[model samples]
Target: MIRTLQSGQQCQVRIASVTGESTLLYSTHRILLEAPNWTLDGRSLILNGDGKLWRLDITSGTLIEIPLGGIPDLNNDHVLAPDGESIFLSANDGHIYRAPLTGGHAQRITPDDGSFHFLHGVSPDGAELAYVGIGGGDFRQPGRLMTIASDGGAPARVNVGEGHCDGPEYSPDGKWLYLNTESFSTEPGHAQLARIRVDGTGFEQLLESKTVDWFPHLSPDGQYASYIRFPSGTQGHPADLPVAVVLVSTGDWKTPLHTWPLFGGQGTLNVNSWSPDSEHFAYVAYPPATQTED
Candidate 1:
């Protein structure tokens, strides 16, 4: 979907410590930034705004746009490849594309199938991509968890039951794909955290709660995880709502290591934002700009 920064909304990019501290890295009312991926070198972050990609240097606090010769506007779903030099992007055109991290022409990966590919994860070895496929580009159809060869070929479906699913990411170890699914509940829009083996076995829910949870991003070390939590009964991670970025130990997701409350959702923590060192992760907030007195 095309996302525009609504009037009076300011985008704030903040880095949070796993231990419970958050630092504002950058804030701007000019553009709407979403879904940050920390660079391998830990020097900068890659985010998409204004239908284009941008690089934010954490230390220097500088923002630069990364131009793509091909491919349409991008969605929040983008994953950095394991090689650290390549990236996989989900464009508004309903196909996936691969491009250089530094910016260049994009190579389309998914075929011109009837389905729309929304990318979320690349394998640890960068051999495959896990994404959600909406058949016939139909939003009414449940998103099916799918995987395809990184270079592009016939996509394979990983049955996630009858319910809709999103954010199928590979574990750091590459053994499992983590995501959120609504199969566990019959209620509409009630997505919960879960994971299944890459081979489509061992499906299990990570935790249960009345609150709707979407993306489950694991740290590089595989010891911790971070996910977005919405209010109970909220339908499909929407914008401009009260949400929380919850951090927890992978060993026990039932307990939260830290919870950072904010007035943001959707683009806030959509992708895996954990820093390479696992000490920090990035997220965005879009709290409306308070009016100034005349």
Candidate 2:
């Protein structure tokens, strides 16, 4: 329940109920803990830390590092397969790779050559994977929302817009794709959560905010959406500000049930994965300023 990071710190992260009772879920000594994805059975958590994917057993409190092998430069948005057999991750090398959960070789899934591919999530059926691909040489330029069959094939663009589209994920039923679009023209960059039918129809905007709200991940039951809400005034540098884990009712996008502030110091919180039961999620909290010995 408590994991001591290698830095000699005791369990720095603790989970408590709304009443403040310790849930004893995780306590890690690791300085950088990000992208915690629970296995399908909920027995283990897969997290990316120290530039590698680690499998932590909940019961035994043992940590095993999954060898990515040849694949390097993995991002935070890796996803586990529906059956929990394999995982799909994004490599900074401009490609997507699928590797076994137990550790083995990794196979490339995208041939994007350029640094246009940004990984998102895999569908519940494991048939398709969604990602963001920018056409212009500069990543700041608006990108495209794309989806491809997991087996490897030509990817298809889902949205046509000038604003950069990113953080694509599928509804629990795989009926719709949820993503965020950031338009430069809008003040503070409007963050729009849109739903696109899998068949590529009925592209509708579900929610838009003047403040940046991205990383839409549907809860396991598919009833609520847990996403990151960047505080206002931190537009272009969202990665450098604190964030809140907000929950929105899927049935009604206008209603927000809960919001929890995270990484309060002058740092940033990058939320990556959600638990299978949707009870708890994992994220990385970075400290902004460090003391230097004078």
Give each model a TM-score: 0.98, 0.82
**Model 1 alpha-carbon drift over 4 Å, by segment:** 291-294
Kindly give the stretch of ten consecutive residues in candidate 2 with the minimal lDDT sum.
263-272
What TM-score would you give candidate 2 relative to the actual structure? 0.82
- Tens digits of per-residue lDDT, candidate 1, 1-294, equal 667777887889999998899889998889889999999999999999888999999998899999897989999999999999989999999999999998899999999889999999999999999999999998999999999999989999999899999999999999999999999999999999999999999999999999999999999999999999999999888998889999999999999999988888979999999999999999998887673211
Candidate 2 displacement at residue 20 in angstroms: 9.5
lDDT of every model, 2 decimals:
0.93, 0.66
At residue 79, give the lDDT of candidate 2.
83
Q: List the residue pairs that clash in candidate 2.
A: 3-27, 4-29, 5-29, 5-30
Give lDDT tens digits, candidate 2, residues 152-241.
Answer: 888888854667777788888889888877643355456666777878788778775656777677777887776677765554324434
